[model samples]
Target: MNRKTLVLPAVVGLLAPVLAACGGSDDGGDAIVVGTTDQFVASKDAPAPLDPAIGYEAGVWNVLRQTVQTLTHIPRGGGAPAPEAAKSCAFTDTENESYRCTLRDGLTFADGTPVTPEDVKYSIQRVLDIKDESGPIGLLANIDTMETKGDKEIVFHLKTPDATFPYKLATPPAGIVQKDKYPAKSAREGFQVDGSGPYTMKPEVEGDQVTKVVFTRNPKYKGDLKVRNEKVELDLFPDAAAMGKALDDKKIDMMTRTMSPEQAQSMLAKPKDGVKLTEMPSLAISYLAFNTDDPAVKDKAVRQAIAQVIDRGAVAKSVYGSTAEPLYSLIPSGITSHTTSFYDRYGEPSATEAAKILDKAGVSTPVKFTLHYTTDHYGPATKAEFETLAKQLNASGLFQVDVKGTPWAEYRPAQMKGDYAVYGMGWFPDFPDADNYTAPFLDENNFLNSPYRSSVAENTLIPQSRREADRSAASPAFDKLQDIVAEDVPVLPVWQGKQYVASLDGLTGVEWSVNSSADLQLWELGRGRDLPEDGVQGEFEEVVLGLDVPVEGHRG
Candidate 1:
């Protein structure tokens, strides 16, 4: 059977008090199966419309983007190209101002569009034109023009020198879209999906769990994915428990990510036979984003009170289990500019202290605010975690959290403009740099329109660091930024997560990388054994998934 026929059944994965993974066998003898705790956003909906110039989260874009070439890639060490995208990348101009890229010849889009200098030029310019709410528009704002120096050669001339230009390209927002396909202004208007990436997302079953996705050979896919499996398939689950159960039952060939930390720990303790778990340090940071712009949150007392009521440790242990660590900094440890500012200031949840902090601000009857979250963006346990936080804050007496939530679809765009007062957010690094942590959140242009609403110093430092490219010079700027973030308390950092996966034995190339944000590269995986039914099963796996999911959480 073809790749689309390989998704796990809905009954195969389920989440909740009890989780199951690797559901019923494919009935196909040789097919490889995998399980994951996350669900697909489904492609039936219109593309969220990313600005090619400004930055934003790539979301599911990563799964198929492998086929398209970028200026740089996180090559596998002792693995594939340690640097797969660009032949060699660097700041050609000493001022850290000018950036250039040289691509491998013969690289082409999934449709066979040649990866040309103009395509690269258009790709970079597209981001600027869209002016996306995410990504680094402030950084790209400096680029004066881009042109093809020659075949396979592209140059970016910045109004000012920036050493971190390469880091900007590393993000999926900067993904190379086919100029022939994507319009210059995907922001003001919808975009066509003729991307230059490795795989084109399969149309029929885009977002549903067990949806259809196929990664074909990019004859021009000279990027790193070639080193792995050529074809890729992704199966989504409503919750992690179902994903885990599927893995235990051997329903799927490999698993990308699973449910809560405790669940992950249990899987690691007694993994299903032949199933392997790969763990990597994650750049992801979890937070409770406060709308500093909110009149209620604008009061320092209320913000600090909410921050005080949160017990990061409890949230980590209760929902994440041992799979994640309590995080107090926007910048995770091991990354530069990390600090214990939040931890040092709050120490731990203290109702008495929180009350005092509010009283000192002069208005202390009791503060209340709705803690908003979304059902889809993060995962299932998210609602539980938010409720857990609400309980803790209410118990503190100094504050009361009225929990509210939206479906992920509506919630994402609302939070991007920083509209939500206190909403949950997970930050996957744009680039593995401290600057990414500080800059994206503060620059007036960042996703959360919070900009300088809370801290002017932060606004100054982000640009200060970006201009200088020197790590040492950037350090103090980031240092002060972290400290101010903690003091202002616009957003509360909760945990730094560890990337985990449980895959069947037949699967290979289960890599652990700092880049790729530890994303599963489906192309590198396939069935070790042949299907029992062969090509005749046609596409049972996908057919089953495309079926309705009962509200009772059973197969429709």
Candidate 2:
């Protein structure tokens, strides 16, 4: 099937916090209830593992991040800096080489141990040196080293100047870990997670069908958003269509990130009696990447020729059916520093132009190559996109395109390693700055490595862009880098994907943020219907908390 099909949820037990009550009024009816169709994929009672290294991307870790603090955090919507685990983060130097953060005190884990700078230092260091197959070590590339200077302060020393350092630290990939709970030198020992967040992992269900994660308000969690409700329980669903059906039947209260384009369209076509739909411009773009090393795709001419043959308009219509929009550059349009380089360099998908380019390269026979795709992730339309691309390329008389498929979980590591001759990938903006878009992929040592022609981005753009503490000040450098990326066709620009959030009418504060990674902190959330306060509080009881996932919001 085309579903992501991650393993299943495991056991369910209560990881009771040392202090569960926030005074007699803590249990009052004021909890904000939210629901999503994504699953935890943890196993049975084996104690749902809490390693931030494993599969902890944007899919679910958003909640866990709110419970346990991070050095920095992108607030729910792409707004200003807000505190969750940190009190404040600021640059100590003008070059943006040195960073410092003051941690909130009186923070304690479920076991009642004080959360101090030592834990933060150890948590990040473990991800850096532990070298487990899991966790987010790749993101720690810019850091030379980090140390705890004071009980309430942690300082990060960079090997090179990088303004995005603070942004990286804010991502859920850097969620705080309990130094005493898991080994700091290797992969997390087991599922029993212990950290200081808003919630704790509860007993998991077998087959991962029904996982019970629990979230309680932290009395000391004086962050930007205060959850109206005290608890949130998440229910896992295997099928997206089935999940949509549940929302219709009210078997579930809400569905977060599990609606297919067709399903979303159908739901939008006919809104339920008490349901609402929130459509917003997501900060992600999906595209086809090329493996320049492969013989079939090795030539620069071949890659450019292929880019010219695929019709972006038709692909967007056929695959998304109006759910997504066409994209032209790595830097999304309308955003500052955006470019039309792809359009300028390759032009529209033209059969005549593509064939001419191929003929000029002296290719008599039809160029043949296999296009790899993923069966899961990014909904069900991906297959159609590939099919259309293949047909267009074949019709050009310049290509004999074949298509291959793999699951998303496998597709990610494979494509990043440049395993596919041509494959698809997506990116969610980690931050709003244009610098965030250009720096990640074209960097010399990026996971995709350097596909573009040699540029100063490696030696200059990276450090210089980072040195500018203000992203707006670094715009010119980012423009230069985008120019480089556009000229280099390691990846062809496709379409900027859109997001549709379907929820019950009672759900308030339904908004979109570029940083969808932090969408699950339900402090300002509330119901619409005129229900008793206890009724809302009862809703909170049903919603479990504590999902240990990574921040994969930028999967573009």
Candidate 3:
């Protein structure tokens, strides 16, 4: 998505009531308490949801981004990677295979230990060494080796010429950690956070689930971001309804990640007192991924037929309302080389067409299969979205679809194990590039851990695209890659989402707090003057207040 601000439609006569209703709270003395539906569950299979090397979900990264500092980070207004812990960084070789970085003078961890090139090397190395099935090892698969040039410089030798490597380093997965604090070869268990970022975290855990995390400004920090809020508290909720209620009761300064369609619509129609809604365009997408090895959907025709019958528009309208739009390609609309490949191939939802494809492949009628989705991960609408999908497929009379809902804790491991014939997943980009959308799902060592693979995408196209220093010049390769995904139908695109952040009228930097990718930049949030009782004097005008950040960038 382009880094630009968006203005919302003006709501006539609604501003006065909203401004009057906006009130103030002195609950956590100068601390901003933010509410979210994002959950972090620590299970036996995934014991360390907060460990940088193991946790790969958006919620985990949300916490990690606040505490762990990266060598390079996306700047506040969403541009190219800027120096964070490092004083400066660049690729040493013309091949884009050898990258180097020089750390800032006197960078130290939260515990006052000075950061070294060795610690940076160890942090990157451990991610590869641990290689957790559900972790972000795929993001670093291009690295051949790492070397420390001096006390402050670190060099990475890549296996291939990957221009996107620096963007990967900007992600939380590549977050720097103290070599001694984190294990060398295993995921560190528990919810403790130790890094050199802008904040110091203190998490409150119940059993394995993290309920609340309190963040305090790090006095020993050095980075690009300015810490606007001295203290921020993130309180977790089970679903959007609970989160919405918390916002209504003045319990939280803001509610982000998700607000249900009904809640968003109601607020938009009749503005709630003291609350302002900011809607930002998102690169985040929700889709269905097939377990290609499973008997039910192993055949390419079976997958294609189901893809043909899915009504993405209906799913977006009926389930998500204005918060989402139907997505037609593996790459969603705002990205560099987005295409309507699915729409071009399928045209529209057609039962007859789907039946013909199934018959041509000699597939059995009423192709009985189960569709699985996570209950709490995406939003309250996910269950409805899948149920609608099942209804759409079953209505076609070519398939008999049964819907099932599982919590993310169990759903993710099951999906990774290829247990679900067809499962729902969402993507928030690791970075703002078409390569992130393709490589992680189509590569041989895919992040999905499924049997699906395309030699064209993995070998030729992906490598060709990465070779271009100018990302736009690589569109042809990405175009072909997206076309290949449409033909194969291993994954079906559903809807592209718009981020909704509901904050009190007095809150400052709500627009700048979340980036385009939907990751929370808590440092951007702060308290500001309350809205005037007379109301905002303007037409329905929406303005992009700050940088577009991720809402909840994860594989939910």
Candidate 4:
């Protein structure tokens, strides 16, 4: 499959809860088959070196969420961070610089080895040591060093005050791994490492490409939630169409990737007899990045003008079929501290105002610029998306647009090197927080490769916002941060999406493990002849997940 076939239409993996009806085989009592796009996996074949330190891909994180226990986890109920491996945790001081966690007693890895605070400290420190650029090491920006006080207690010393530290730990970046199985300085390449999560992968079934990897409930897992299915066979498909067809054929029970608007709409319209669709709001954002080094968009006025001229609502409706909504801020909706700063500053799409802004900057109309996007990385609608955007800008007579496409392998490196004058970028939150939106883009030498500068967001708002333990006070700081992003216009928020899944009728508890981020709790999935018309939410309880396999089962 091509890169486009690999990536889902929207951010496919994150956190979620809801209930629905779907039918499947109940022969094994509790066994379900899951179908997803192959590209979601960090490494196509197996979870080897499933080390969280180097595992940043959405698919990898999705699997890791079930296979490895973290210090904390955002509940499916969508409130504060709840304890996972940690029995109890809190900030030790008012400055929010020191965090203390007490490990739950009797915690053990898949091999039945005790999981201690020392292992927790090692898991975090090792990630920082490896420091893979493609990894989630960036999420641990606040930690200074970790201290293990006895076998049960651990404390994290932060270099700077960060109220969001606990949430960071809840992400896969802090997924605890077995110290003995993984080396301290290097990554455990392949599926050799030990994980203490809800389920264990059957090593014998692991393979490359479309091969199936079966996940069986970890008998050693100490989590409270009972596994709805004894086994979940994850089968990757080349594209959405293939995955959808398989779902209809009953070859697979569920899907994780986001479908194209056309596919989703068709699925809804046709209404398969035994299929039910469920939708959940997501924290994902798709936007355009202006390469500040490119002379065409180097000027803030030109960037701002493009932001003014581009019609997000039109693109959302025409291309995405309202599956995605216009997003005016980097911090997406459904989260506190989100603000529509771009809409406030530029109002609706306007050629007149765009022309005035360019004119005021002494730049002539009919501005020439190139827009680059990944042909297959974002989704099939990417081409239509940029084309619609080009039409909106071109029709205004304020700019002439030349749109281009590239594969993800070439596009990611190129965009980061400022090779593209302007490009499209999709963001999936590392954790559900406003800081994930700002810090990655606005910080000095951050994610965007362009030489775009925003001192207020970098020096003032971001730092101040991270320090504020109280979200209410932090909201105003984030509000200012969005306004600054609007003024600088380094990137433009095009749209925010809601997550959806299509499953056969008679399936129940599809929503039990969904946190605010759209991650599915596979353990919560099961089949039922009759389910509630008004879906019920799943209960919340923290449990330590065990590794996917026993020590002898690992194939390194």
> Which predicted model would earn the best lDDT?
3
lDDT (Cα, tens digit) per residue for candidate 2, span 1-556: 0000110010000000000111121235444433344444544322233465443344445444555567665545443344456666776876667777777655566567777888887777777775433234556667787878778888888888766676677655477777756676655533344566555545345664345454565544433344554555454565566655655555454455545667656656876555555555455567777777888877777877877877888887776766667777777753556768777777767878877877788766587788887675555567778888898888877788898879655665676566778876655554555655665567644545435545687788766776665555666877777667665677776886565655444455444311232244544444543323432111111111111112223321
In model 2, state the lDDT of residue 150.
Answer: 70
Model 2 lDDT at residue 166: 65
Q: Per-prediction TM-score, please?
A: 0.80, 0.82, 0.90, 0.86
In the range 1-556, model 4's lDDT, one tens digit per residue, is 0000101113422212121323243345446777666343235322343567766555556667778888777654555676777777788787888888887767788789989998998889988888764456667866898888988999999988888888888877688888777789887766433577778875323353225556777766654345666677666676667866776676666766545667777765787666666676677678888878888888889999999998888888888774788999998887678889999999988889998999999998788988888775566688898888888889999889999999665676677567888888777776666787888778854656457777777777888987776665688898888988899898898998766655555676665544335555777776663223211112234432210111111000
Better of 3 and 4 by TM-score: 3
Off by over 4 Å in 2: 1-50, 54-56, 76-80, 131-135, 189-193, 207-214, 218-222, 363-365, 449-455, 512-518, 528-556
Ranking by lDDT: 3, 4, 2, 1
- The sequence of per-residue lDDT tens digits that candidate 3 reaches over residues 186-240 is 8889999999998999988898888899898887787767777678888888777
Give the candidate number with the greatest TM-score: 3
Show where candidate 3 strays beyond 4 Å.
1-28, 529-556
Candidates in order: C-alpha RMSD to true structure: 10.1, 8.4, 7.6, 7.1
lDDT of model 4, residue 447: 55
RMSD of 3: 7.6
User: In model 2, which range of ten residues has the least summed lDDT?
Assistant: 8-17
lDDT of each: 0.55, 0.57, 0.75, 0.69
Model 1, span 473-554: residue lDDT tens? 5678877888888888876888776665445444554442112243444454443432232221111111110111111101
lDDT of 1: 0.55
Clashes of each: 57, 50, 19, 31
